[model samples]
Target: MSGLPPFAAPMPLDAAAPAALETTRKAPTSAWYALAVLIIATVLGSIDKVILTLLTEPIRQTLSLTDTQIGLLQGAGIVLFTGIATLPLGWLSDRYDRRVVLAACVVLWSAATAMRGTAMDYGVLFVASVGLGVGEAGLTPITNSMIPDLFPRAQRVLANAVFALSAIFGSALGALLGGTIVHLTDDLRPWLPVSMQQLEAWRLTFFVLAAAGIPVVLLVLSIRRTPRVGVPAAKPGAPAAVATGATTLRAHLREHWRTFAGLVIGVGLTSVGLSSLGTWLPIVTARTYGITPVQMGQGMGLAFLCGTVAGGLLGVGAMRYLQPRMGPAAALRLIMLCNFTAALLSTLLLFTRSANHNFMLLGLLVVPLIGSAVLLPNVLQDAAPAHLRARTIAMLTMASLPFGVVGPLVVGMLSDALKSVPNGLAVAIVATTLVGGALGAMVLRATEGPFVRLMRAAQPT
Candidate 1:
């Protein structure tokens, strides 16, 4: 506890750090425009993930699938591949035009999502999900890597808050609009070819969401490319390896493993609660109230909308109130504070039988659960060398898989295991939240020294 496990500290990642651009300097017109596009695209990607959550019950009924199978499709089947895919994709983002990379991924995932409608059974659906996962894998790392280069450090929390908020809005839309689409598509089943008249509503919903991504792909294609600010412009004769940090990637990670470990593992643990809740909340709602999926969508969509706003304000407010006064280290501590509360509130969500009470607790859980999403990436961008930004973010993305992949899968297994219990899935969810929160806090506390050291190294001389 006195210090992090031995790892070299070196000058924190960006050795030839670009001059930090001031927000007041030059027109930030293009940066904001590009950010808007990124937000829209990410929303589409988020919808792709949450749509499964919205339709889990119907899919289970249609396919006669068990809760565990549904959970596997939503959790590990998607995120495990996402975790595996990020490494190569991160490398491409580091070396290529990220806008092009992003656009390509958007098209790939959109196509995969549309293909999901054609699945005849669980195996095909799972394979389609794996494709969706791979496509989405390219998004976060590329976007987070690009953000710091576009906005000044002073404004990064706000930028990240906006980014995080868009994901929330997208998930909310998935619930609100996805449910509505499912309801409306019931009429279209009649017009289907005789063989397909029995096609499920969820399949049509997937098609509608897939169509939404097409416009986003066009939007991404139009964004102007920006320079990679993490890497200094190469000297005229310098090798490409030097320009991209490939030669030093291993050495940098070797010495700075503690910094990366603390940030990645700590933040990743907190994601378990978020992942579990996202997958199970709809099922929980239906069981408790007997509400239709459309009604469930309305309640959840509005709650998520409120939670997004609250999360954004907390993330930005923490930076405004803390960073200027106490520095980036303090801002990092603010995330730890949120993590602690999330652990407490998430457990409470399972204790209540009242639908209203559970929803209120969920809103509270999200405030802190999402605060980490807005803050941790800023910390990663600050800690990693510019040339290695995408890979580092990708590393963080992969870290979340342990918990993100397991949380829902375990909840479903637990639900089935304890079916006779009054609220088995709810219990499993709360138990997972408690464990993830506690472990995250411990890592956050343990890694504080490493984080401070890294922040000090990143400071302007």
Candidate 2:
């Protein structure tokens, strides 16, 4: 905030601009550091987000809540709060310190998550879930905006890939650890404040889960913030708006309207598929295959783990192999095309009649996991200018919050709506995912030319 620099006109295009066509950069050791912190924060951020989703079954029984009520809990409370909170937090990220915003977010969400255990009634718990959304929503924008600044334009794909794949990381960690937290909390009945004799272990799980976030907050506090890029070295001729007005949210939005709109649509749709699948996959595997949650966790968790790791590798490694041989646009276009196809197939396999079918389809899903993993973050960084990174991410967060917005509860609605076939929820998952994949993929294609030029303009003097 203190080191104010004057702005310059958008520089003329040159060979350096075309080089940005292949936005690959030399490797940085700092990237691994960024990835490690991003991964851990992502893991907890996800657990906090989906912890309620995982607890839906047990919470339903304890509160004597109907499926409709549960839907509101997941969809309305979680999504609405996130949508509202992201704006201010994102604005803060762009103007203030990103690490501070991220650290505060982890702390805030974690505390809210812990409070969820103490809810006496539906309204209290619902508000707490909203608080969780507010906190979690702040996360994506702050962190994402930081990635491009940390590495060169060339490395943004892999860097973004590591950042984006945090979804799979979040799901696997939430499901895998949510089970363990519930199982371990079984013995602590007396240590709790009330006789949770009738209450479910999942309540305790939420408390323990929130407690795990403290260290992540500490880790986030350690990272350094980057200065705004694209602002040129000052000539000190006539001065411009170097005071607060230059950094206001209104100014930023007006300047970056196109990028913001694209982000809204892109992140929103992508989130619907992500949230619905993540919030309910364990249940899907459970009812569809008649497998226990533990077994479902193991199988699905492994698939996510493989897809996540492979996606990370593809983010960094694939560009090096492809961009020169095939050209930047060709490399990205091919990946996006294939990734969309993979998403379509994954949806088909996911909704079909057989467990063998779902599993086999999921096997194929890993390949496209690379798509969501690699492309999303890369594209976002490409689209945004340096100062607007966090806020834009916040806007994306707001847009995407709608994905989970009505996502989880829709599953509950389907279950009760068609009483006999409880797992009929698969219909919604298939529908939303296909819709989201298509919309988000198209936006990616539309933005490529703009980003290629931006990247070329970014090479250091």
Candidate 3:
């Protein structure tokens, strides 16, 4: 409840006057430490979400579930509440101590993830999936909102890039580590009790992943609170305001409707393609090649790690190079092109009969996949006002869930129609990517003027 030290005094949310800003020689070691811990927490959350993808076949076979059901569990079932809840949760984050909101979410999701290990049927698993979504709803908004405060404006792109990498790492680790644990569980099955033996390796994998969250929660709690940067400092014992007006939200949207709507829908479309592919690629490769889940996990995990890293670094470089010659707007166009290219290449997976070729395409896909993910947020965050950052991001999160809900489910349904899961998923991914990328590009082009104006307003004279 105590106020930050004098040096850490909060500035008004609307402050644009240079005098109101804090001048620091550099962000303190504590800030960097906080960044490290946040990344670790994100990694844990991603593992919980991604392990489900690894276990799809196992869960489907065990529960007598269909691909549509698995997609629902992965997509809409999890995100329905996640999208709805984020508005309120995001408001809480903007108004309260983000550390508290973040810690609570970590504990909640971890518990929910652990519950997945105990699910007996469709109903139980559905509830657990819902719980997982509710818990995860708070993460992206809180984390992205905090990054700008933790680092300066100039460094936010780099910082956001670092944060985005955690998802990649977590996905990789979930496959690598989750697959390893599942393999181990198979070995240990003989020595286990009857109750445990009845449970599958997939179930035990969830348990292990859930247990991993404990340390992450401890890590979240261990981080000392830092003042929310660029906002007015509250009195030591006073509560921060929780309300933002509908009028304010409407007016902001009205002024920059193009940027707001375009980015949200554009990014949302992009998410459909990305999420569907991420959720289904492992299953596709496994089903197609008759490979073990463990091998697929290892292959995909290493590929993601290597590909995302290369993509991200190259993205930063591309931005710098293009911004100078083509201007920021044109540079953004280049980033979108890269995304479209990745999506276009993603279709090639279906044509290749060889696992090696598919894996190579997956790796190649990562370059543009990670590139677009990192830069798009940079553009969005730069355009949004400080006071509305969390809510704005939450809005995007809410909007994106529809894609999350439909993307995977549609792929599953399409696969069912085609009588081939692998081919159907590939067709679905390519279709979504092309549609999403084209729409995103159209909106970006239409809204460039509004986006530029907002970016200018965010700058100090």
Q: Find the candidate with the highest lDDT and give its number.
A: 1
Q: Candidate 3's residue-wise lDDT over 381-404, tens digit each?
A: 655556567788787777667777
Question: Where is model 3 poorest over a 10-residue stretch in terms of lDDT?
Answer: 1-10
- lDDT (C-alpha, whole model) for all candidates: 0.75, 0.63, 0.74
Candidate 3: where is the Cα deviation over 4 Å? 1-24, 189-194, 241-247, 420-422
TM-score of each: 0.89, 0.76, 0.90
lDDT of 2 by residue, 134-237 (tens): 88877677667666556655565555665667766787677677666776678777667776655667777877888888889888876643444443233343
Q: Score candidate 1 by TM-score against the native.
A: 0.89
Model 2 CA RMSD to the hidden true structure, in angstroms: 6.3
Question: lDDT of candidate 1 vs native?
Answer: 0.75
The segments of candidate 1 whose C-alpha lies over 4 angstroms from its true place after superposition are 1-23, 187-197, 230-247, 324-326
Please give the distance, in angstroms, between residue 390's alpha carbon in candidate 2 and its true position after superposition: 1.4
Q: After superposition, how far is residue 348 of candidate 2 from its true place, in Å?
A: 3.8
